[model samples]
Target: MSALDTDRYHIFGVCTPKDYCLFVDYVIDEIKNHESSLLQRIQETPDPALRVWRESTALQGTDIFEIECVKDRETAQEAVEFWRAYFHSLGETIIEAGHLCDRLD
Candidate 1:
């Protein structure tokens, strides 16, 4: 079993059931495949009603797929930076650079 960190980040928002399902599928695949694209991960939780995630790697729980990356400090920083840039590129007003990112060690 992969160890997960819960106090790293928080992902939450609004989206639809279909979107949430898609998000979950995407997340499962990403984690399974060990894909490290912060942008894709950040946007995995699509749009519709409500969706939330974080950096705890616990997105494998609850509804509306969440991405809480619970990695070590070193690896976690890299993930956070990647997501920060991606979130900025997405131009998400609510999801700022550090929205789905964890503070560096």
Candidate 2:
């Protein structure tokens, strides 16, 4: 379990290896393109959406990723929606590419 697991809600998912690679690249580019704005958002929000990506660790040899979020059901739900939007923006669907689950630790 992650250190964040104890106090945070988690959004977990599994995707194709291909999609996982694509997501990593996309997030890298996104950070590059919006560093200043992203940083400002991080500074202003105690639990910014991107915090999950920042705190996550890619499971070696698997397509699973789990995002830890602030321990609020509403915040967890928002993160779930955020990921769904991301998949949609990438021309994918959660059902086709993988699945998402939320839980508090």
What C-alpha lDDT do the candidate models reach, one value each?
0.36, 0.42
Tens-place lDDT per residue, model 1, 3-77, is: 343343333232233333222111212332333343444545343221343433233323333445433555545
Where model 2 places Cα greater than 4 Å from the true spot, the runs are 1-6, 18-61, 96-105
Candidate 2: tens digits of C-alpha lDDT, residues 5-96: 45445454445454352222111112233444433433343443334432452323244455443565567666666777786688763442
lDDT of 2: 0.42
Which candidate achieves the best lDDT against the true structure?
Answer: 2
In model 2, the worst 10-residue window by lDDT is 21-30
| The best candidate in terms of TM-score | 2
Q: What is the TM-score (0 to 1) of candidate 2?
A: 0.41
TM-scores, in order shown? 0.28, 0.41
